[model samples]
Target: MLDLWFSEFHAPDAKLSILVKEQLYSEQTPFQKIDFFDSETFGKFFTLDGLIMITEKDEFIYHEMISNVPMAVNPDIKKVLIIGGGDGGTAREVCRFKTVEQVDMVEIDERVVRLCQKYFPQTACALDNDPRINLIFGDGLKFVQDAPEGAYDLILVDSTDPLGPGEGLFTTEFYRNCYRALNDKGILINQHESPYYKEYAYEMRRAHKKLASVFSIATVYQFYMPTYSSGHWLFGFASKGLDPVKDADFKRWSEFGLQNRYYNPGVHLGAFALPNYVQEELQKED
Candidate 1:
C-alpha cells in the first residue's frame, strides 16, 4: 500500500492536505499549473498553481452563493458577465434563471475551462449546451474596460486569489471599469477571499475597500466551504444602489420555484450578517 497526499499551504504555520487515490491529470498552462485528483472524502477536485480551486463535494456552496445572491437581489437580470469562472459553475447557476438572455463568460485560460469540461462535467454542463453562454478567452480587466457602457445587468467575478493573473481583477481601475460596464442598477459579485488566514484576510479587506470606493453599495457575505481555507469563505457584493439584504426580492425570487442544495431565502439574508470580528475587519481602515 502506498500513501499519496496533496497539500495547500494556508500560511507559514498552517496547511490543508488530502489523501489522493490518483492524480488524474497535470498540466502547466500559460497562466498556471492545473491538477486533478481523486480522494475518498472530497470525491474529485482540482487545483491551480497548487492551490485548491474547487472540489466536487463542496463546490455547489460557492457557485450557488455567488450566483444566487445577486439573482435574488435582481431576479430579472437579463444580461450577465462572468470573469474568471472557468469551471462554468457560476454560469450554470446563473443560466438557471430563464430571465438571463446573454451570458458572456471571460476566462483568461481556455485550458482551465477545457479540462474542467473533461473532468468536472457536472459543473461544466452548461458551458457548451447553454445557448446564452458565450465563452471568451481573454483578460477580465480588459474585457470590462472595453465593455459597452451599461452592457450587463450582472457581472460576476469568480476569480482566483489576488495574485498573478487574478491580481489585476482586484485593482481600483478594474472595479471602476466594472461599474462603468454595468447598467444603472447592475450588481457585481466577486470572489472575496477568506477571512480566517492573515494573508487572505488582507485580500478580503483590500478587495472590499476598492469595491467601496467604486460602488454605491459594497458589502461582503459569508458562506462555509470546507475545502477552502478555514471552511469559512466570503463573496463581495457590490452594486450601483442595491443593498443585497434590503433590496433582495425574495418574493420575486420565489416565483422561480427553484430548489437549491445550499442557498435559500433565509440563508440569503443571514449570509449578510457578518460576525463582529469580520465586520470590524471591514471597518478597520475607516
Candidate 2:
C-alpha cells in the first residue's frame, strides 16, 4: 500500500499534513507555483508557492466573512474593488448583493484565475458570469495608486501573505492609496494575517497599525479557518466614517435574504469583540 500526503509548514515547529487521494494539476506560473489536489476531507483544494490557499469543504467561511462583514455594515454599497482575489470566491460572495452595481477585481497572476476557473469552478464561478465584475490581471498596489479619489464604496483585499507577489500590498503607501481611493463613507477590508502564531502576529500588528494610521475608523475582526497558519484568523476593517460595529445594518442586511454558512448578524457583532490578547497585540509597536 502507498500513502500520499501534502504538507505545509506554518513555522519552524508547526506543520499541517493532509492525506491526498490524487494530485490533479501542478504548474509554475510567472508569479508563483500553483497546485491542485483531491482529498477525502477537503475535496478539491489548491495551493500557491507551497502554501494552502483554499479547500472546498471550508472555503465558504473565508469568502463569506470577508465579503459580508463590510457589506452588512453598509448595505447600500454599490461599487467595490477586490484586490488579489484571483480565485473569484470574494467576487462570488460580493455579487450576491443585488444592491451592488459594479465590482473590479485585480490579481497579480492571471494564471491563478485561469487555472482556478478550469480546475476549481466552485470558487471561480463568478469571474465570467457576473456582468458587474471587471476582471483585471494587474498589480493591486498600482491599481489603488492610480484609482481616482473616492472611486469605490468598498475594497476587499483578499490577498496572499505579505510575501512574494503580495508583499507590496502590505506597504504604508498602499494603505494610504487605499484610503485615498475610497469614498467619504467607503470601507476597506483586508486579510489581517493571524495572531495565534508569533510569526503571523507581527504581520497582524503591522497591518493593523498601518491601516489604523490611514483610516479614521479601523479595527480587526476574527474568524476561524481550519487550514490556514492557525485556526484563528483575522481581517482588518477600515473606513472613512463607518464604525463596523456601530454602523452595522443587521436588520437591513437580513433583508437581503442571503443565507450563509458562517456569517450572521450575531456573528458579525461578536467577530469584532477581539480576544484580550489580540487586542493587546494590535496595540503593541511592531
Candidate 3:
C-alpha cells in the first residue's frame, strides 16, 4: 500500500495537500501544464501550471460569488463577456440569469474547455447548451481590445493569478480596454488575488489600484475557497456608475428567485465590507 498526495504551495512557507485517489489525467498544453486528479476529500479537481483551478466540492463558491454579485446590482444586464474561466463554472452561473441575452467567453487555451467537458461535465455542461453563449478560443486581451465600444453590459474576468498567460489580463492597459468595451452603466468583475499572504496581497493591491484608475468605482470582495491558497480569496468589482453596495437592487434580484449555495442578497452586501487591514493595504502608495 502507498500514500499519494497532490499538493500546491499557498506561499513559499506554506503548502496544502490533498489525499489523492488517482492521477486521472495529465498534459502539457501549449499554454501551460494541466493535470486532473481524484481526491478523497475534495472529489475531482484540476490544476493549471500546478495551480488549482476548480474542484467538484467547492466550485460553487467561486462561480456564484463572481456571477451573482454583479447581476444582483443590475438585474437588467443583457450582454456579458467572460475572460478565462475555461472550466465553464463561471458560464454556468451567468447562464442562470434569463435576462442575459449574450455571453462571450474567451479562453486562451481551447484544450482546457475540451478537457473539462470530457472529465468534469458538471462545470462544462452549459458550455454548449446555451444558445446565448459564443465560445471564443483566443486571447482575452485581444478580444477586449477589438470589441466595439460599449459592446457589453457586464464583463467578468474569471482569470487565474497573474502568471504565465494570465499575466497580461492584469495589466492597466487590459483594464482600460475593459472600460472602453463596457457601456456607461456596465460593471466589471475580476479575479482579485488573495489578501492573506504577502505575495498575493501585493498583487491584490496592485490590481485594485489599476482598476481604480480605469473605472469610476472600484472595490474588492472576499469569499472562502478552501482549495485556493488561503481559503480566503477575493474578486475585484468595478463600474462606471453603479456602487455594488449602495446601488444593489436586492428586491429586484430576489425576484429572480435563483437558488444558490453560497451567494444571496445579504451575502452580496456583506462581501464588500473589507476588513480594516485590507483597506489599509489597498490604500498604500505605490
Candidate 4:
C-alpha cells in the first residue's frame, strides 16, 4: 500500500484524537498534550512518540546537530549512512556538508517518509532533489549487517528514543554492526537517552560500555531537546582510531556557507564536553 493512502485517510483527525485524548502510553513520552500543531507550509506538525520534531517549518536544529557534528569532526567524511531518519530531516542536514559525497537513508517506515515528504516539504527538500542521497525503505539493523564492512566514512543513527519500535537500535549487536560498517577511521554518532532521567542515563551507560570495546574512541555528548521531560539529551560517538572528540576538523562554522541557530564551531566543541557525573557513569567499564 502506498503511504499516501494512509496519510490521506488519517489526515488531521488522528492528530485531533491525540490532542483530545492526552493519554500518553508508557512507551511514549509526551512532549506536549497538544504536540501536534498546524503549520502554514506543512499543514500539521505531528510529534511522533514525543521525542522527534516532525514539522515543515523548523526541523533544522535536530538534523543539524546529528549530522553536522560528526561531519565537522571528521572533515574527510565522504560516504555516510543514516539509520531510521524516515522524516528526512537528517538527510537535509547531511547534504549541507560540501565534503560529503554520498548519503544512504535506511528507514523502516515508508508511511512516515511519504507523510513527511507530503507535509514537511522543507525538511524533505534535499531528499527529493539531491543526487547524492539513496533512500532505502527497509530495516536498518539488517541492512547494516548485510552491508560490506568499511563502506561508510560516517554513520549517523537518527532514530527515536529506545521506547518501542526504536529499542533494538540501541543494543550492543546494532553497535557492533555499526562498528563493522565503518571504515578504519569512520565515525558513528547515535542519539543517547537523557541524562537527567536515571534509567536513560543508565541505558546510555550500558550502550557506551558496549561501544567502547569495539571502537578505539567512545564518548557521549549533551544537548538540550526542550520537548523532552529532562530537557537534555546524550549522543554517543565511537570511532575505530579517530578519537571522536579530539579529531574535530572544524575550521569554522561558515565552512558550509549556511545559516544555523544552535551550532557554531564553539557550540560544536562545547556540546561534547560533558559534566562530572555523566562522565563518571557513562565511562564506567562493565
Candidate 5:
C-alpha cells in the first residue's frame, strides 16, 4: 500500500537509495542517532547518524578485510585492541583466531553494542560469548592513551567517518597513542575512508600522512563495501616492524584453515595493490 525508501548521500551531488521493507527500530543514543531497518534487497541493516554502518548482505567483506589481513601478516598476534567497532563484526572476525589471547573492545556508545546484539545477532553474537573479549564503554582515544605501552599486538580502528563521536579517533594524537600502545611487532588497522569522493579522499590522505609519520611501516589496502558511500573503501595497515605485504606469511596463514567469504591468502596480497590514481594521491605533498 505504501512505498518506503532509505537513502544516503555519497556526495552532495550523488545519493544511494534502498527499498525499505520496514523501519525496525530507532533511537538517539548520547553519542549518536541509531536506526535499524529491514530492506528488500540488502535484508537487515543499521545506520548511525543517518550513515549506513552495516547491512546483512555484504558485511563480511568489511569485517574480513579489516581483521584477516593483519592476522595473516602475523599469525602470532596474541593481544588485540579494537577501538569503536560497536557492531561487533570486527570483534567476531578477530576472535575466530585461536592465537589471539585477549581482545579489548572500546566502544564509545554502549547502545550500539546492545542494539546490535538485539537486532543483528549475526554480527554481535561473539560480543559476550567470547571469553577473550573485554567490552569497555568509553572514549576510544582515552582508552589507548591510558593503556600501558606495548599492551596490544594489534589495534583495529573500526571507527565511523571522521565526524561526530568518531572524529577524535582520526586525529594524529590518537594514532600516536596507538603506536605507543602497541608492541614493537604490533600492527594497526584503521577504517581509512573511501578515495572515490573528494570529502572522503581528503580524510583518507590526512589519515595516511599521520599514520606514515607515526609508524615505521604504513600502507593502505582496498575492499568493496556496497552499503558504504561508494562501494570502494580502504583500511590502513600500520606497524612498527611488520610490513603487511613483505612480511605476510601466506603459507602459514593458509595453515590456519580459516574459511572466509572474501579474504584469503591470495586476496591478502592483492588487496594492497592500489590503483595508480590512489597511489599518486597518497604520494602527493600534503
Candidate 6:
C-alpha cells in the first residue's frame, strides 16, 4: 500500500506552504504526482518514479514485452497460458503471433475482466472476438497445479503485486506448479519485482531460486516503466532446456517483424545480461 504524508515548512522569506504526497515502498515517502488518468476499476492512475502505470498503459507495456519476447524466441509456440491477466492485454498480444494455435487465459477475478471489457475497452477489446483464445475465470494456482503435465508450451504469469489476492502466486509452490504444467521444452514467464528498488528483492530471490531448482536455465530481464515505484522492473524467464541467450534463433525474430516500442531482437538478447551484483544475489540461497 502507498502511504501519504503531510507537513508544513517555513522559509527565510516568511512564506509557508503545505507539502503532501504518497510514500511508495517502505522508505520512499512523499512521492510526487503528475497527471492522474481514469481507470474503470481502480478509479485513477497515479504516476511515480517515471513509470506510466494506468490500467490501460500497463496493459500495453506488460502484455507487449511479456508475450512477444518468449513468442519471438520460440517461433513455433502453439499452446499458451496466461495467468492473472484480467485486463486481457496479454491474451490480445498472444493472438498476434499466427504460430500460436491456442491460448488459455486464467484470471481469478471475473469482475476485473468484465469491468475492463466494459469500461476499459482499449485494454480488453480483442478478448471476446478471438476464436483461438479461451477466457477461463478461476484461481491461477489451483488451475496450474491440476493441469496435466507437459500441456503448455509457454506460460505467462501476469499478476498483481504480492499484497492481497496475489500472495499465493509469489510462493515457491506456485513456481513448482508452473514447472509441472509446462511441456518438455516449455517456457514460463513471471513478473518479478523491481531491481532498482530493494523492497521485494528478498521475495523475488526466493521465487528465482525455486524456478532455478526445476528449470535448466532461469534468467531475469528488465524493462522501464514510468508509473511504478522505480523506473526499472524485472521479469523471470525459466525453461526446461531452452538457453534464453544462446538458444534464441535470431532468424525467427527477423521473420516475425513484431513491431514493439520496447522489445526487439537486440533488446531480447541484451535483457538476459544481468549485472554482476544481481547475478551473485540471485545465485545466493537466501
Q: Write the per-residue lDDT of candidate 1 for residues 244-271, one digit (tens) a residue.
A: 9888999999888888999999999989
lDDT of 4 by residue, 55-78 (tens): 444455667788777877777888
Model 5 regions more than 4 Å off: none
Task: State the lDDT of candidate 3 residue by residue for 36-155, as single tens digits.
Answer: 999878899999999999999999999999999999889999999999999999999999999899999999999999999998999998997999999999999999999999999999
TM-score for each prediction?
0.98, 0.98, 0.98, 0.81, 0.98, 0.80
C-alpha RMSD between model 3 and the true structure: 0.8
Q: What are the clashing pairs of model 3?
A: none
Deviating ranges (above 4 Å) for candidate 2: none
Superior by lDDT: candidate 3 or candidate 6: 3
What global local distance difference test value does model 2 have? 0.93
Score each candidate by Cα lDDT.
Answer: 0.92, 0.93, 0.93, 0.72, 0.92, 0.70
- Quote model 1's TM-score: 0.98
Report the number of the highest-lDDT candidate.
Answer: 3
lDDT for each residue of candidate 2 in 1-286, tens digit (9 for 90 to 100) = 3499999988889899999999999999989999999999999999999899999999999999999999889998999999998989999999999999999999999999999999889899999899999999899999999999999999999998999888889988999999999998899999999998899999998988888888889899999899998789999999999999999998899999997999998899999999899999889885
Off by over 4 Å in 6: 1-58
lDDT of 6 by residue, 244-285 (tens): 777787788668777777677788877787778777767766
CA shift of 146, model 6, Å: 1.5
TM-score of 6: 0.80
